[model samples]
Target: MLVLITYDVNTEDAAGRRRLRQIAKQCVNYGQRVQNSVFECLLDTAQCRSLQNKLCKLMDPERDSLRFYYLGKKYESKIEHFGCKQTYLPEDPMIL
Candidate 1:
């Protein structure tokens, strides 16, 4: 499945700044960041739930917002992109 995770953390204080960094770090662990606060992650049900759990713990409901869009297994045609960055399938083989 392709999971699009987006978040907004109130960075008006030191604690909020720290929370933002921590959230970004965790997102990087699970996927590629396509935007400042948006990530494209390919994960299974269990993995998605796990990531959600981790994020829930990191965010303050009153001060932060998080969203997850599940694109299921056939997500290719579901997404369209246009910009500088080229899009690639998460399952594509990398020869590096």
Candidate 2:
């Protein structure tokens, strides 16, 4: 199956980006990160769970912010149902 994962980091600091990248690398060949904080992962149930665990570990306690969304579907599904629903929004402008 293919899974779509989206994540939002609470801050724009270097630490946040570094943590995000570290978590993403865990997926290796099973996933491809399509956006800065979003990743399109292809995996089975076991792989998904492993990825989730790794993501939780990458979070910083001081930040108090970590969020992830996962969407999964069988390989035979239509293309229309796959991919991101919206374009990436800049973190700066959205704050105001």
Models 1 onward score TM values of 0.94, 0.57
Give the per-residue lDDT digits (tens) of candidate 2, residues 1-96.
566666555558888778767766764445665666556666778988877777778877667354544444643333344466553322224332
Q: Give the winner by lDDT.
A: 1
Off by over 4 Å in 1: none
Q: Rate the local accuracy (lDDT) of all candidates.
A: 0.94, 0.60
Q: How high a TM-score does candidate 1 get?
A: 0.94
Q: Can you write out model 1's per-residue Cα lDDT over 1-96, one digit (the tens) per residue?
A: 999999999999999999999999999999989999999999999999999999999999999999999988899989999999988788887455
Q: Report, for all candidates in order, the number of backbone clashes.
A: 0, 0
Q: How much does each candidate deviate from the true structure in C-alpha RMSD?
A: 1.2, 9.9
Q: In model 1, state the lDDT of residue 58.
A: 96
At residue 49, what lDDT does model 2 achieve?
A: 82
Locate the minimum summed-lDDT window of 10 residues in model 1: 87-96
Task: Give the lDDT of residue 18 in candidate 2.
Answer: 85
lDDT (Cα) of model 2: 0.60
